[model samples]
Target: MRAVIQRVSHASVTVDNEITGSIGAGLVVLIGIHEDDDEEDAAYIVGKTTNLRIFSDDDGKFDLSALDTSAELLVISQFTLYGDTRRGRRPSFSHAMPPEPASDLFNRTLRLFEQTGLKVQTGRFQTHMEVSIHNDGPVTILIDSADRHRTRRG
Candidate 1:
């Protein structure tokens, strides 16, 4: 599982000209599932997305998290997040999980997010969506479950 978490003042997803999900002053999460993803990956993503300290504090420091701020969430499924583009001009989605299993995992992840007690909204899965995002502080973070165990260089 992978997620692109962006702190946003507002965000909404529209499907077929109808608004499916919307939020205010929270985070917009674009999630993607890999072919080998499982419950552990979903757990990792939910834990990090809700607990990450990307929001600013009263002193203007990055110290508050979605959990601390009571922020809303707008989750969107984006299989393109797993697009492998290194091989040629066209991107390959061979690593993205198929819709059947991916949707199941996505729903489970949403449940996890809701368990945190924050308001969660979601886009229509497997549909064409137009997402409007007002990124707060332009704060964006990328997380990948596959990298959880890797050590970072100092």
Candidate 2:
């Protein structure tokens, strides 16, 4: 599983002109499930997303985790994260997990986020939706379950 986590002042997802999910002062998480991903991968991502210290402290240092700030989360299923464009103009999604199992993992991941006690919102899966994000600090972090060390703070 891979996730693009962006700190946001606010974010929302709309489908068919209807708002499906929205959040304030939090992170917008775009998650992609790999073909080999499972519950463990989902768990790893959930832990990192909630605990990563991307927020700033009073001294303007990156020392506050989302959990510390009680930040909300906007989770979205983003299979396109796995798009392989090495070959040609067209991006191949062969590395992305199939929709059926992928959706299951996505839902499970969302549930894990919700279990964190912080407010959690989500985009509609497999739907044509528009997302609005107001990025905070323009801080963005990429996380991959396969690359555990990359997400760790020294």
Candidate 3:
């Protein structure tokens, strides 16, 4: 599982001219599930996303976590994050998880996020959607669960 977390003043997702989800003053997380990803990967991402100290504090330092600020979250399923373009002009998604299992993990991840007691909104899964984000501080962070696990083991 991989996540691109962007701190945003606001964000929204639209599908077929309808607003699917929206949030204010929080993070917009784009999640990509790899073929070998499992529930543990999802759990690791959820914990990291919630505890990340990307938000600024009184002295303008990055000292606040989403949990500390009760920030909202806009989660979007983004398989393209796994696009491999090392070979040619076109990108290959061979590393991405198939739709069925990916959707299951995405939903399970959202459920876990909602349990955190903060406002959690999500983009429609397996849909063509347009996402709008007003990035705060233009802060963006990328996290890969596989890399995290590898680092922990060593």
Candidate 4:
């Protein structure tokens, strides 16, 4: 599982002119499930999304988290996050999970997110949609489940 988390002032997802989900003062999470991802991957993402100290505190430091500020979430399924373009100009999605199982995993991940008691919203899965994002501080973070065990180097 991979997640691109964006701190946003507001965000919305529209499907065929209808607004499916929206959020304010929170994060927009573009999530992707890899072929080998499993339940632990989902859990890892949910944990990070809720706990990452990306939001500012009263003194203007990066000290607050979604849980601390009661931030809303706009979760969007985005398989393209796994696009592999190392070989050619065209990207390959062979690393992305299949739709059927991926959808199941996506829903399960949503359930896990909801358990945090935050306002959770979602875009229609497996559909063409438009996402409007008002990035706050233009803050973005990338998380990959496979890197959970790797130590960061300075």
Candidates in order have lDDT scores of 0.95, 0.95, 0.95, 0.97
Tens digits of per-residue lDDT, candidate 1, 27-133, equal 99999999999999999999999999998899999999999999999999999999999998999999999999999999999999999999999999899999999
> In model 2, what are the clashing residue pairs, if there are any?
none
RMSD of 4: 0.7
Error of 1 at 80 (Å): 0.2
C-alpha lDDT (0 to 100) for residue 135 of candidate 2: 98
True lDDT of residue 124, candidate 3:
91
Candidate 4 achieves a global lDDT of 0.97
Which model scores highest in lDDT? Answer: 4
TM-score for model 4? 0.98
Tens-digit lDDT string for candidate 4 (28-99) = 999999999999999999999899999999899999999999999999999999999999899999999999
Task: Give the Å shift of residue 9 in candidate 4.
Answer: 0.6
Candidate 3 lDDT, 1-154, residue by residue in tens? 9999999999999999999999999999999999999889999999999999999999999999999999999999999999999999999999999999999999999998998998999989989999999999999999999887464543
- Compared with the true structure, model 1 gives a TM-score of 0.98
Instruction: Give per-candidate clash totals.
Output: 0, 0, 0, 0
Model 2 accuracy (lDDT, Cα): 0.95
Error of 1 at 98 (Å): 0.6
